[model samples]
Target: MTGRLYNSEQIRDIEQQAIAEMAQGDFVLMQQAASALLGLLKQRWPCRKRLLVYAGAGNNGGDGYLLAAYAQAEGYQVAVKCIGDHALLPKAAQMAKKATEQAEVPLLALSAAFKADVVVDALFGIGLNRPVSGDYASAIEQINQSSCPVLAVDVPSGLCADTGQVLGSAVKASVTLGFIGHKIGLFTADGPDHCGDLLLEPLSIPQRIFAAQEYSARQVNGAQLLAQLQPRCAHFHKGQAGHVVIVGGDFGMAGAPLLSAEAALRCGAGLVTVLTRKEHVPALIARRPECMVHGVEAQQDLHPFFLKASVIVAGPGLGQQFWGQQLLQQVLMQNKPVLLDADALNLLTQQTTPQLKQLILTPHPGEAARLLQCSSKEVQQNRFKAVQALHQQYQATVLLKGNGSLIAGEKDLQLLNAGNPGMASAGMGDLLSGIIAALWAQGLNAETATALGSWLHATAADHLAARFGQRGLLALDLLTEVRTLLNQPCSG
Candidate 1:
């Protein structure tokens, strides 16, 4: 719940420090890990009598060996498959292997076929820096193909603890038990896909040890936003809430700005305005009459509306044409808080603008790549780095949208722990931009607005997905849920 994420190296350093401080030494730490793994196995699979452990030649394999020994002592049918040369194991692993052998546990070869109620993956841990190959790779594939539930130790084998990129292929764990520190990779990119039901046990490390190391990123959820959300007083009027102007909806694309405007209104923006193509104004009002709709054809048309707005949600459907570019120019010229998405972001890539103090840029991988002049693949490879790069380049709060939405500011990096695949549908980003703009207009700082808005958007999507399933989930379906969640108290 602390939501601090560390890289593999940082975790290793913390572990070493913890081990050095403990009187029982490194083996005791290993024993604690084994005990925690055993406890989880017993709690999760009480009736299952068999446990198969896949161990490699490092400390990870040692944990599997120790777990096998403990399971054997507990009277379960335990089998350990050593994937590589047993002689290559480190001293601690050899000690665990010896303990397992002394307990009369069976050590099987990689080719041995065995069925189990549960499988523990200790093949590779956070220290893994190379691609899984040969017997190790084969074992991971077999584990994935098996029906038995898998509990990955520390980290799922073959997953980069720093970037969450799969090294060759990683084990898909039913529950990954992370120790010492939470790895940033487990919450981002491919990490979420491979690590199911992530649980951290910290191995009883003291808080001071963690305090000694800086976390790679912090996580934000709805619970953390509750204190910042104040209940409205009876005397409060609509005018007290700020007005949000959405500038987009060029020509054929009118739905984008409407979505943004509606979201803003739903999130408690006192008044919402839409400035788009002249022809789209009638439909915009018809769809949502609460929104003050204005039709604009020229730069001068938006000037008056721009002056009245407290915050601007730019570039939902703003095309990269002359009109969209002109609108973006006008929004950028304003000193008010701005949330830029879609074409506004695309237009940003075309021109250089002075770094504004109150700005939030929400860019998906492709859009981020465009802004950074890199490939989407590169952007995703290390999302933490990408978000940081964006912040440094723009000197603005950058929200990188993906599996784990990351917000990078001048001082910190935060990740959103909500959202699902159902949000992949169109108009999601526009809705998100609107929510952020609304919160900013309502008096939240740019950073708080970005974090809370991201959480609200994702949490609403999750709630809707739980009801109707992920497929056929529309962006509009989340508007009501967003209102409901915003009114509720924060659980954290």
Candidate 2:
């Protein structure tokens, strides 16, 4: 979990260097990887009786062949299937095929439809650069149609190891056992969709081997940020924690700002205020009496609140009309620590302002697309590139939310792997914006607040998803868990 993610070419270079430096042959490394795969399979399916291994014509196929041989020796019924032309296999794979034949394991044709307790996909690998078609596509289709569980070798076949884009079609792996360094693709884009359970096996490569290469990106786990949540002092006062002002909730959109304000309060902000449309005030106060809700019809109405606030959460439920624009302009003028999300992002994209520090922009793919003047598809295609572009353009801490939420700043790029599909509902982003603003108000810097807040928000959603299934999980479901996590001592 601590190593860096490398592209296919970089991983190959690392493997070659490891093999040369350790004097371990390619066959030895293949055997070790095959052993690791076998161990995981046995551990997961102790009573599995049959295994179907679909191998292509590369080192990946060689790993499958070795795994098949080992499974046969372990007294399981093993069948090996070759995709494409078997004669085109590499030297290492040819040796593995020979060993499988020597062991008398049946070699099936690519078109053969068979059933087994488990399917091991070795077709293609991380090096796949083109769309899957012809026999290879047929094999993938067959694997997908099968009811048996599939274990992907190295990476899911046809999945881009660098970008997680599917090459036309990709194998849906029940479990993907990665080797060497972690691939950045496995955690973003279509990666989380195809890779059901991802586990990395380092093949015992020396730590120094990784030191020779640079990491593509690092994941942001909550453990690293827990230290920032120092226990409050015994004599702490509510005013000392800092007040947060939430500006958004246009006409008929009071829930957005209300959610943000409540989240700020739950995250331990000293005091929370909501400045929204006049119509939403009574309902907001009725729902959360602790929040100081104010009805603002003009920029002057927000002046006092803006002056008193330590941080601002902007854009939740804020419309694209003139009222939201005026509020945003005034909020920007205050130069307070700001967490921009929802409609505020849309408004920001429409206007250009001076470079602002102490700003955090949380934009889901669509909002991010508007900010970058690109399509959501493009934003999702290479999220790393898109987030970095946002940070560079706006000079603010950026959190791009999706399957694997990415946080980008001037000096760091982080990925959060915590969240579930249940968080797809509305109000989640509002809650996240509030959490970050609260953290910032609580004296954490912009980058620290963003990193810690994103992790906490997603991890809380995950905890809720575990308790109650992923479906029907509301944004408010995360409040209790968020409070619990913030109060807990840092285990790290």
Candidate 3:
């Protein structure tokens, strides 16, 4: 599946829908799921004879009980520990208890044997919503303490499946088996820590079921979506591509505009031009002689230059002074496809400007916080909401930059798993802004340009890490990598 992402709530809905459509009883599905879990365990640990299953009072635990029975049937010594009393157990749990008893595996409490070759943690699934406390928390702690390998079902207990945040404390597993659709949380935030090497299974559900759901929460890399753009004709010309113009670069920040302009040129923009402070013009031209660099001390100087450009990337080193604001106001006045970054975003947020659909804003957490009139901590707490809020308020494609940078548009959203810690350094964002502008010039809308550019920038960084350690990777290092990526065969 391509670009399929789902939060905890959506996953629950899918599960319920699948259950409703099933002709068999819920117990049958639980048994099949449990058998699948045991099968995975056998494949993962073929040598392990002793098995431990942690079961709770819910359906998750019912799966655990059935797993124990399957393991026992497979000629392995199995032990089951139910977290709650029999009376408190859910209906599924009761059925599973009967099956387990029929198999002669007596259920015990938390005090059951802990010495096992592998531990199956089926105590909780995606229903977790609170902090781990009391006996459940203690049992989770013990599971982590165990030297044996642990496998988590659905999700690790104590993880917020919606946002990938820790509910308080969560189980650490060596592997996680995700049934049906994979939760979007598993690839972001604390999900990675809880869900180790993830495995997905559809449980034989028909493709029509997924089609009925209409979920678009997940996204793959840009190359997969843009495969048709590759393998340019041998006779392709520069004019057939697109032109990108970047306007920014106040007195001391010429490098910002230059970087953006160069990046746009590298990412298949046919012609690249830079409008910056007059003082930096000569240096920019000298550094990258291929670009048409212009010096603009006043906003009036930008008129003629702006007219000829297909896409405009505004604000890299733009300061928030009257001069910067004047330039920005003029840029906004022009109804062009625009990519805004750095001070441009800050200026827009400060002014509380009305939503503009033709613009894409790439803001770091701090910039996004300022735009939303909230604390950075609040945005970081739930990035999904922040991106959604940005899209709603500005009517623009919003790229919230940070760990697992999120891109949100009118009705779609995606998280980028590319990039590295080294990208936290200065000037990386400017480079990204440039790449997006270039893609915009190449006839992609804000969503496609922003998503593709963001992914390509990060992927290039990953490639850089392969050649040289990530320690000193610079934004300029991405230049060659992007060209190579654009020229390579696109593989889905």
- Which one is best on TM-score? 1
Q: Candidate 1: how large is its RMSD?
A: 1.8
Q: Work out the TM-score per prediction.
A: 0.97, 0.96, 0.89
lDDT of 3 by residue, 51-169 (tens): 88888878888888888888888898888877756578778778887888999986677876657889889888778878888778888998899999999987888887777778778
* lDDT on C-alpha atoms for all candidate structures: 0.89, 0.88, 0.81
Error of 2 at 372 (Å): 1.3
Best by lDDT: 1
Residue 336 in model 1: lDDT: 79
Candidate 3 vs. true structure, TM-score: 0.89
Worst 10 residues of 3 by lDDT: 223-232
lDDT of 2 at 232: 79
Off by over 4 Å in 2: 1-3, 490-492
lDDT per residue (tens digit) for residues 333-449 in model 1: 887778889998988998886467788899999999999999999999889899999888888899999998899986568988899999999999999989999888888888888
lDDT for each residue of candidate 2 in 105-171, tens digit (9 for 90 to 100):
9999986656698999999878888899998999899899889999999999989888888889999
Worst 10 residues of 1 by lDDT: 221-230
